[model samples]
Target: FFGDYPREMREMLSSNLPKFTSEEKRLLQNKADFIGVNHYTAIYAKDCISSPCDIKTYEGNAMVQAVGERDGVAIGRPTAFHGYYDVPEGMELIVRYVNQRYKNTPVYITENG
Candidate 1:
């Protein structure tokens, strides 16, 4: 399972403790019959260059603990693909990258529209 980017890090400790990810790759090496990857949407992470957030700064959404607001709308620099927005080449690149890294691993991508 590729839990690469946890939407919000405020789970238990850090604000975006993106768990699993490469961790599972090591932990479940031969433990499971089928290796699964659940990737639907990608996200951009914005680490605080400062400290813990105050009450007003966090607002009511615990998910977005200390993000910024522009024109009264909360936003972050999404971890989206560099070119997927305009072309499908991004998908090809991802496949090529994955192949180069995991040369012999059986692969499956369980995604939906």
Candidate 2:
């Protein structure tokens, strides 16, 4: 993994994000042997920063809304957990994203349901 925060995160959070010193960067760089992902389900993310939305707990403070449906159609089959959908493709997408983002670092599905 990179030593510092991602460029997109830094841009979004701006001064809200803490800076890392050269020593911290050196210590953090490529320190992880692998990435562990606990994937439960995939939900559509709607940007609330640019548009108005009814903020919910699932959305946290990221200003992004977690939506399970679009155009009156569900993203996937619903699970027992509210707002969670069983979307198999999400696993593939997440794994691919993590692999590419982390420079092809080894990844393990630590938890899934």
Candidate 3:
């Protein structure tokens, strides 16, 4: 992984994201041997910055809304948990995302259900 946060994230968060010092950047770069991921479900994300949304969700600070459904259709079969869903494709998508983002670091599925 790179030393600092992703460029797009920094741009989106602006001053909200902390600045990394030269030493910090050096220390943080490529620090992880492998990436551990816990994937359960995936849902739609709605940009809240340019649109009106109920910002009460956990991702409120990120200026995005986590949506379980779009156009009144559920993203996948619902689980007993309120927000979580049974989306098979989410696992593959998440793994690919981590691989691409972290430069193909060895990944372990630390926790999944």
Candidate 4:
């Protein structure tokens, strides 16, 4: 639910993933005719202490962001909020990643934001 935030907060959130920003730049090298922007809530990420980082990461409820309940309940995948984040910024990263990893192509994020 990253709907409301001040400019300062927005700036701060945007800074969390520096690697994604860089990758976006690399993608612009070839460029495209049309540009599309999709928006959504940003996700929170964390490192797994005991298990491998990959295992700790889930695509359902847990998703890419590391979220935990305030009461210490371990939240796993399949929860309602798993992929429900309002992180539209992730679209930016997706476009950027695609541009950097593959040939530059016009991009449009079609799924829900």
Per-candidate clash tally: 6, 0, 0, 10
Model 2 error, position 49 (Å): 2.3
Residue pairs with backbone overlap in model 2: none
lDDT for each residue of candidate 3 in 6-84, tens digit (9 for 90 to 100): 7788887767778889999999988898999998888999888888887774533567888999989999999999998
Best by TM-score: 3
Model 1 over residues 1-113: C-alpha lDDT tens digits?
23343334345345435345566757745444433343433332343334344444333434233334444543333335431222234345555666665566665655521
Give one digit per residue, the lDDT tens place, for model 2 in 18-98: 788999988988888889999999888888878888886542547688899987999999989888899999989999999
C-alpha TM-scores of all predictions: 0.30, 0.84, 0.86, 0.31
In terms of lDDT, which candidate is stronger, 1 or 4? 4
> Which candidate leads the pack in lDDT?
3
- Which sequence of candidate numbers ranks them by TM-score, best first? 3, 2, 4, 1
User: Candidate 1, residue 47: CA error in Å?
Assistant: 12
Q: Write the per-residue lDDT of candidate 4 for residues 1-113, one digit (tens) a residue.
A: 11233455456454543343555656645455644545544444553434344543232223233454324544322235554444445666777876665454566665544
Clashing pairs in 3: none
Instruction: After the best TM-score superposition of candidate 1, give how far the Cα of residue 21 lies from its true spot, in angstroms.
Output: 18
Off by over 4 Å in 2: 56-61
Question: What local lDDT does model 1 show for residue 4?
Answer: 42
